[model samples]
Target: MRPSTDIDPAIPLRARDGDVEAFAELVEFFHVRCLRYARYMLGEEEDAEEAVQDTFVRVYDHLGQFRPDARFEPWLFRILANRCRTVRERRRRRESLVTTGELPAVAAEAEGMSQDLLEEVEAALEELPAEQREAFLLRHVEDLSYEDMAVITGVRLSALRMRVKRACDTLRIRLKEER
Candidate 1:
């Protein structure tokens, strides 16, 4: 489902114009959602935090490059997604040095969610390829439109639709087996 944020487009514009409070406002506005998305993308709290931190830093550094007429969410997500990829790559290289069986912690625990169900779902998610998981989270979790996802991911609309469909089908089957 879509997030509840009713963003004011001019905030980023103000930040682009070197307004310090506006920059902080931008960070405050998107921080939670960005953290959640980053957690899903990176699969760890620390990595997600780093990705979000790096994203805001990059956004702050390149505010002048932001297009005044553009939608801020997609642009911001584009940066965050790239940061996630970078962080994930680094983790892969590090994992080659050490091994662990621990699963990444959930970003946030929903009330009334059973531990068994959360574990099953997390295990299922970890099974999917990164592209499929990314597509699924972007489409279903973030509720971004295909056009926005296209911009954020640099993937074609048809391919994204296919990815989401595949992800849904896979999750449906995997979760069903748990019942």
Candidate 2:
């Protein structure tokens, strides 16, 4: 009997059978938040996209290894986060690192955001260290609890909290700088 915690039945079963389409469904499910996390951690669209792709490939290879008791999203995010780390290391080695591109041209302010506000948030995210950025994204963007963050990152819970705090402080300073 599958102990249910709200997973798509199609995913684990089909994925274990080497079904690429079922895996693609998983990718589609995670794509937006994964891209956001990759973008924030890697500081570039291309790198983020690559991280997401690499994550999916790794997921395919490791599908059979997934524990039945685990939450799929956080597990997948963990793989994505690790890939982002590797991508960042490679970019550092390459030494021609580029930050995320400018937001698409904003003709008019939407809701409560101005273009400058969007730019400031982007800039702050860009300045965060990779680990800090990953912590931030996992905590706030993905709304994962600190325990979940620890599970995903394989860090102690206290350490994950500290990383999240530092990330928040750094982002606050960066946003302050824009004032």
Best by lDDT: 1
> For candidate 1, what is the total of clashing residue pairs?
0
Q: Write the residue-wise lDDT of candidate 1 on 44-106 in tens digits.
A: 778888999999999999999998889899999999999999999888653321213354345
Q: What is candidate 2's lDDT per residue for 79-102, written digit by digit as tens?
A: 988898888888776432355566
Task: Estimate every model's Cα lDDT from 0 to 1.
Answer: 0.84, 0.77
What lDDT score is found at residue 43 in candidate 2?
A: 68
Checking candidate 2 for backbone clashes, the offending pairs are none
What does candidate 2 score on TM?
0.82
- Model 2, residue 114: displacement in angstroms? 1.6
Model 1 residue 81 lDDT score = 91
lDDT of 2 at 33: 79
lDDT of 1 at 140: 83
Candidate 1 weakest ten by summed lDDT: 94-103
